[model samples]
Target: MIGNVPSDFRLPTSDSVIGRLADDVVLSIEDLWVEYQTPAGPMQAVRGATLEIRRGEAVALIGESGSGKTTLGLALLRLLTRTARVSRGRARFRIGDGRTLELFSLGGSDLRRFRWQECAMVFQAALNSLNPVLKVRDHFIETARAHGRKDDRQTSERARELLRMVQLDGERVLSSYPHELSGGMRQRVSIALSLLLEPQLIILDEPTTALDILTQRAIIDVIRSLRQRLNFTMMFISHDLSLAAELADRVATMYAGELVEVGKVRDVFYTPKHPYTVGLLNAVPPIAGEEFTPLTAIPGSPPDLLAMPSGCSFHPRCPYATELCVRQAPPLFAVGNGHQAACFHWERVTRRLDVWEGAVR
Candidate 1:
């Protein structure tokens, strides 16, 4: 099932873009753990999530609902809810300079100073994030001021530039209120606001979730254009595998708070090594052949995080799982060039896939 870039696939590119694709690790996140502190007990929301994000590229976090994709993204930027906490792991982040900083280690002014200026977030429900009472210009002014933009004239100009960057008419959009704009336009404005400070990394937590299919496609195109022009890296968090397939150079599939598989989009989509990833790819409707085939389901719901099953979290739902899969936690095993999966029987799993495909015919 492995193939090179398909004829229809495309991604943003620019001569002005900084850093080679897949060459530099802009953010080094290691064994990150997150939990929600409750009276009952601390409930783990994310477990040992680890990966490195390359500069000027999109790395997508994709999985079913409650897979902790959102939590992991929130934890990376220290934007979790008050009740939640990042108890373990570290994210080493590098900005314009070569120097790196442990994001969680910094406190008070240090963290405040680094955040937004270097990294920004485009929230899930970004359309409703705007204040109904304020004008669009006011929103930009507030963001600029919070980041210490003292001169109103300069901030206004920058705001106009950002509006233009997102293909919006600066004068009209700046004068209008949030209620006046369409859902898609408001979402674009949110993205423009994220780039107001020219952050090196942008966390897009389901930016296109609420939009219609056509609107979603337009927004994705806008993001690609912006990324090409601005050269800012992105972490796209979504459940839409098709959307992830378009934007991401690399794909990380999460399951039950852990990353089950991570590699190039072509690798994970066409030649998945993890059982969970396999199930997900199978479920997605194909655009070409097999258009009339029955939609395949993974056959079971995800495990409850509060009372998670022992050993491999995905073993319960995996068709190829064995005694070893239920007895010991499997480490990430190398499957292909720069591809890895947490499965003890990945070799046997691939063979079963072939046989299963034959039976389907």
Candidate 2:
């Protein structure tokens, strides 16, 4: 069992609430834009990002470091710092009983209740997220109390169950401080804490960051197991394409704050239509290829968010760029079954499928 809830545990489920309708979608973001106020000017961190995460589906948002993957994740939970502002967007989240809540508009006690009870976010830095002074058990107690889980005995039992699920010894881990545990242990604790409230959706930002290869593999296994047992909706934000391929049901490629491609894991990896997505694939060495496959890095760096390039932000580095690409930004065009790419020369990408196929093999 995921969690042994108290007899009175319940989430708000009013049928009167209404928003944009989406069947089977747990979270739907439409035309979302986020900006950060800087010394130079406003930095466009996330731009016109629209995607739907269905119930119990794992969606990976993959991109380069500055491609706004983390920014978008933070925006969804309203966890952005004071410097950042969500300029415009509609993030409609499905609550129980066929009701949809506009996430961006929530405030005060409603927002507080929505955060841990409905959705949770595991931050990138696990060590920093945990308090140095607080013991592991205290962390669990505090989080549970904050979300109205008042029964200390029940809360501790739930925390222990979650910790065991993540492959940690509950009794031992509960007594230790954050500094006492290894990097992997801390990460596992964070994962366990995120599940303490039995959230319907969880957003993990680089959950395997700053860990050894062995530890990363362990973390991956733990995540896979948790998903199988609990079946919560997840949005995994990462620059690591290999890990994303292994964990995600769907892949959404982001470039300069815009979603360049969104499709099934197999479709996006094997037959990418966007040049940026293809470039990303070319850069990573395949896990199973026997022969030596030369890695081809995408030329140039990610554009400056303050003064973004004209038309398609990726046009400067695209191998198949045309005059039209420089003059007009391309909207996401349907390429295949549930596959979309924002590229005028997507057909060129299709012609070169053999190259990508060989790279992955």
Candidate 3:
């Protein structure tokens, strides 16, 4: 029903309905590894990351500053810089006609068409993403034209509709240049441009970065509304845990260039099995607490990607880490239904939380 998708292409009626079909995989990544060439050595940015995004669901990748969340997102779209390469991986993306396309294998016009027509990305810096010389309307016109949509009237109307969905005055916004708009306005314009192609999967990297708290709230609201109405799959990268809890059905925690934990939002937030995830939760201040709860910072900074620690990458900071954790990296172990954590002492993490809660009382 949207843009260039086949006439029979159908999305679920509601964004709330996740896992509607067992085979409803919009995107699947397996053993994906990405590295950046550097003077010292090749820095591994994403390591053996595997994930499946169901149709019409929002998945949030959360972690500390150098946790490889952005790298993974960029790799999925094949938008990595020249210095970076997908060392080895398979990114299978389902197209409108139900054909799976290997993103890494796409080349020439096939890769270009896949970029915006099937999947679009709204990068972190909205100002840097837009052309200073081009007016907002010109941005839309150019994007549509590049994607083979040359009908000026139809493209303008579509852009207006998308801008309005993000709660912008389409006419005024379209007339203004990127520099003429505020930060929030520019961000909204980027969001509008992404939807102009009616891509089924949208990758939003730090959507609310550098915005005021009020403006961040507005962006989140707009994204939520758009997802419910349009019913598209989304994967947003962020360090904000609260935002992930609010916007995502699933939360994937990345650490040291690998996914350390993944589960339903409630499951990950309430009963996290990974020590790294627990540390992240402890760092965030609770909103509904009666007394002033002290926030606990995760011990030590993120490890150097170029010279990562042996065994578990997080073991250096994990309290429950043992001799085995120091000698062997743990693979993702099943924690709960559709939940997995890369931790050798997952049971100990649960027990530690129980003890912490009792002490808090």
Candidate 4:
């Protein structure tokens, strides 16, 4: 949608400004429970997971492929597939204009209208999300026109401007279809469309997963710029911890349908408390320093959700698991400085080890 506006255009505003304007919480997920009705029975995807995203804050949901990050993200928008249902939970979204809506209770038209207009999603695959039949400008026009905020003239101008914001030439990209553009370019277009509604929050599910390294960097740059300029909150869902750490103000780690840890990005990165968090950090390639050691992958795979363990789901794979970890589940307890981890021996695990200190190698 945003093509050829300008490469030199000023980026968006920081979270600080958005925080000031809308003081109330923008998104709150309280004790969510999502389940899928498989032949084996109801398999839980999210079990009593709670999270919050303030206005303009960039939060990331990080975990493995089936760790429920995408499920949680979809639940936030009530976009789950037919088989998957929200068994128990409350997701409250307070819009920019002081309107509150409970996503679970909202029905047909309301849900559809609110989806992109108030909260939009940029899914993992670009081709799947975008219509190959339509031109870039037409897509933007359709979205903009749906809201009735901008007509043809205004839509055209906004489309061009939006393309420019994503570092694409407006004219060329506007005329192009899904196949004509590169993967990264298509992603940018998706981002631009997501912004058309000027939604208060945008959920990006593995936005850069399909792109090459260079294009991925460009897309990340665009996200950063947009976040700065737009001052909107974001829910960045990804399996890549390194990328999440680079963009998010805070990161929430999920393991086997449960939230394992959540805290400030630096806290989660530098001083991860949960064993799963530690494993994830150790598994990701370091970006800041050249002297860092190679990543260590988590030994075992996640357990089957249909018949999970009695206590901690991560007990099977966690090296630090003890009798307590195997007997009873741990709650997300506050560790320090807005850091929390669902591990009984977080203190012991975090204190006795310093993997990044060149000692673990």
lDDT of candidates 1 onward, in order: 0.82, 0.88, 0.87, 0.83
TM-score result, candidate 1: 0.89
How far off is residue 164 in model 4, in Å?
0.4
lDDT of 1 by residue, 110-137 (tens): 5665578888888888657888999999
Estimate the TM-score for candidate 4: 0.89
**For model 2, the run of ten residues with the poorest summed lDDT:** 1-10
TM-score of each: 0.89, 0.92, 0.91, 0.89
lDDT, ranked from best to worst: 2, 3, 4, 1
For lDDT, candidate 3 versus 4, the one ahead is: 3
Local accuracy of candidate 2 as per-residue lDDT tens digits, 1-361: 1133334434333431455456699998999999999999898899999999999999999999989999999998889999999998778887644567788877766678678778899988999999999999999999999977789999899989999999999999999999999999999999999999888899999999789999999999999999999999999999999988999999999999999999999999999999999989888886685898777767778898988889999988877787999999999999999999999989878535344332321
Compared with the true structure, model 3 gives a TM-score of 0.91
Q: Which whole-number lDDT from 0 to 100 does residue 305 have in model 3?
A: 93
Model 2: what TM-score?
0.92
Off by over 4 Å in 4: 1-22, 287-292, 351-361
lDDT of 3 by residue, 282-353 (tens): 878877968987766666778899888899998887777779998999999999999999999897786244
- Candidate 3 residue-wise lDDT at 336: 95
Candidate 4 residue-wise lDDT, 1-361, digit = tens: 1123233222222221222213557887889999999998999999998988888889999999888989998887888999999999887777544555677777765566668878999989988889989998889888877666567888888888888999999999999999999889999999998988788899999999968999999999999999999888899999888788779999999998998899999999888899888887776665667696666666768889988987888887777777988899999999998899999889866533343333311
Superior candidate under TM-score, 3 versus 4: 3
